[model samples]
Target: MKKRKIFFVTGARSEYDIMHPVLEQLQDSGEIDLQLVVTGAHLSETFGKTVRNIERDGFKIADRIYNLLSTEDKVGRIAGLGSQVTALAHTFNREKPDIIVVVGDREEAISVSLTAAYLSIPVAHLAGGDIANDGNIDNSVRYAATKFAHIHFTFLEQHAQVLKMLGEDEYRIFNTGNPALDKFIHCPRMEKKAVQPLIEFNIQDEPYIVLIQHPIITEVENAGDQIKETLEAVIASGLKCFVNYPNSDAGNFAIIENINAYATKYPDVFHLFKNLDRVNYINLLRYASCLIGNSSSGILEAPSIGLPVVNIGSRQRDRYSAGNVIYTGYDREEITAAIKKSVFDEKYRAEVKAIRNPYGNGDSASRISDVLKTIALDDKLIYKNITYKVF
Candidate 1:
């Protein structure tokens, strides 16, 4: 039997990590030939050579497109997208796959979706149908990708409904849950002894919070100030803080600068890491007092582990959140209160600990892989019709 070639495009470390399980599933199954394309932040040294992380996981990379500009500004992001489209055009022309699978709301995913749409390739999008109402360009890019996608794997049923409302066919949308949480479904949490060697700083007996803030490109100018507020709030909470670097987004330099400045002042209480292995990262989240960030992980992954999250600012604004998340403004006082509430408030902690995660069961990769294994690869899928619904 001829194997259907399924291509996957991974741009940043976060997307690669989230989508890695699906790739593993497709590769493990004998039905499809897996083609992995690495690009964007994966190639950037500033992003910690995260492609090595992918390589370390033993997936063979089919192509590497170096499109990310050294500068992580707005113009550079656009240029990177254009470069990706051109490079992927060459790749698609050379190795036309049955389908292209992309995840999340990054520029690289948008570029791949657009290129596949133009190339008449079936595009499967994961984690669509959710919106971040903030002024982030990811909102528009995500919607555009959804419109171009032939198959949508949304994390929640509400997201699938939103995709249908956006004119996507009901039959083509699957509420498979967040693929990021799949690995944690039955995996045992890494004990402190196992995770201790992974980080440079000591995990003291005192409670600590995990902070993973990123810059919203629309609010780029205030990125530094926002990080400062979070730092102050974390310090005010009197807990040790584990600061993870921001994504390789346009305004990340400001956040990095603020983090570096804070590290110097509070070396004892503030621990910094460039990046953590997947196991170590999840272990940190599993044992953290609370997660404080604008990262989607706060909204999507924290609830699965029953971790409390204090989400600050508008980067993740208006995104679907679980009961475990506390939304607060960027002001230091508001952020401080939320952290204190998430950490020390026993009633709130009990409520968070008892809530169910709206994101589906952690088997999204298998659900997506099963669909891809037998999905019809024909001209019909290439030419999509708007399933217009009367609202």
Candidate 2:
């Protein structure tokens, strides 16, 4: 049989790290021909010029869609989606790929995957049926992406079951584990000192907290206030706080401004980072006292390494979690209490350390690739029955 041609679409700070191994194996192995497409933050200037990072890591980008929205407002976001879909439609026609692979539920990923779906290309949707950030399009994006795609490649077995409950074809859905966890399990925990240079920190001596908040798309106006509460909580707790930048959402600039101002006043207390490439991120993540964020990493990536997470607010509101997570409102006191308890409580820390990740082991990339090769490519691939939601 001839090799299958798989095209991958990624946008703005989704877990590109998760796909690293999958892409590498597909490219290196003779069975699959890979065509990678980069859009979203990969092409944005305000987002650390991240596209260069994609190329620096060594993968072929077949399409570079240029649509950088200034304000993180719904209008700009929707417009950008319109532009991206148009550009990728051209790319798909030229590439004529056998299958399209999209990861996560970011707006850009949804747009690209939708483009592929409209063109009648089979899509392999990863990280569907997970929950987080109530206002975030993540839940809607993931679920909607699931509707358009053929294969469901979820990060957790529980998530796969949820997809089946949501009416996805059980035969087509496979629990490949999270691609992000693959990096965590495969690589040695990066010594805190080894990653110290990435941040201008004296973190080699003691523990620290990592902040990774994304702008709430639904409440774009109050983002500055929410970010203030997050910062105040970190400062009030007196924990060594490492601030990771937010994603390129409508109100992302406000979050950036808050981080910049926070960096200036706190000095050593703040471990400033532009952005971390995936491996260094997972490595350092293992050592953080606790992750303070509304991002999905807390629910999905942190637990695999037995890392503790203090998830704040509606961002990750109703998500599944490992035993290591502590949920609290975004109020400074609530955030502070959660952080202090998760980090300083020795007995609790030991309990968290003993808990294993409920998500799968490290064979996700391989298993996902195995199914991509074997699944039939026909109308039956695209057509699926909607299983009734059990009340």
Question: Mind giving the per-residue lDDT tens digits that candidate 2 earns over 1-391?
Answer: 6778888887765567767778866777768877788877877666777777778877778888877678756799889888888888899988899999888777755786788888888888888878664777767888888888788888777788888878877788888887666776887766777888776677777778999988877878988888999999998998788888888877788889998898898886776676677777776777788998887788777777777888877888877777788888769999999999988999998888888777767777788778887789999887667767657
Give the alpha-carbon lDDT of every model.
0.85, 0.80
| Number of the top TM-score candidate | 1
What is the Cα-based TM-score of model 2? 0.94
TM-score of 1: 0.97
Segments in model 1 whose C-alpha atoms lie over 4 Å from true places: 389-391
Q: How far is candidate 1 from the true structure (C-alpha RMSD, Å)?
A: 1.5
User: What's each prediction's clash count?
Assistant: 0, 5
Per-candidate TM-scores read 0.97, 0.94
Clashes in candidate 2: how many? 5
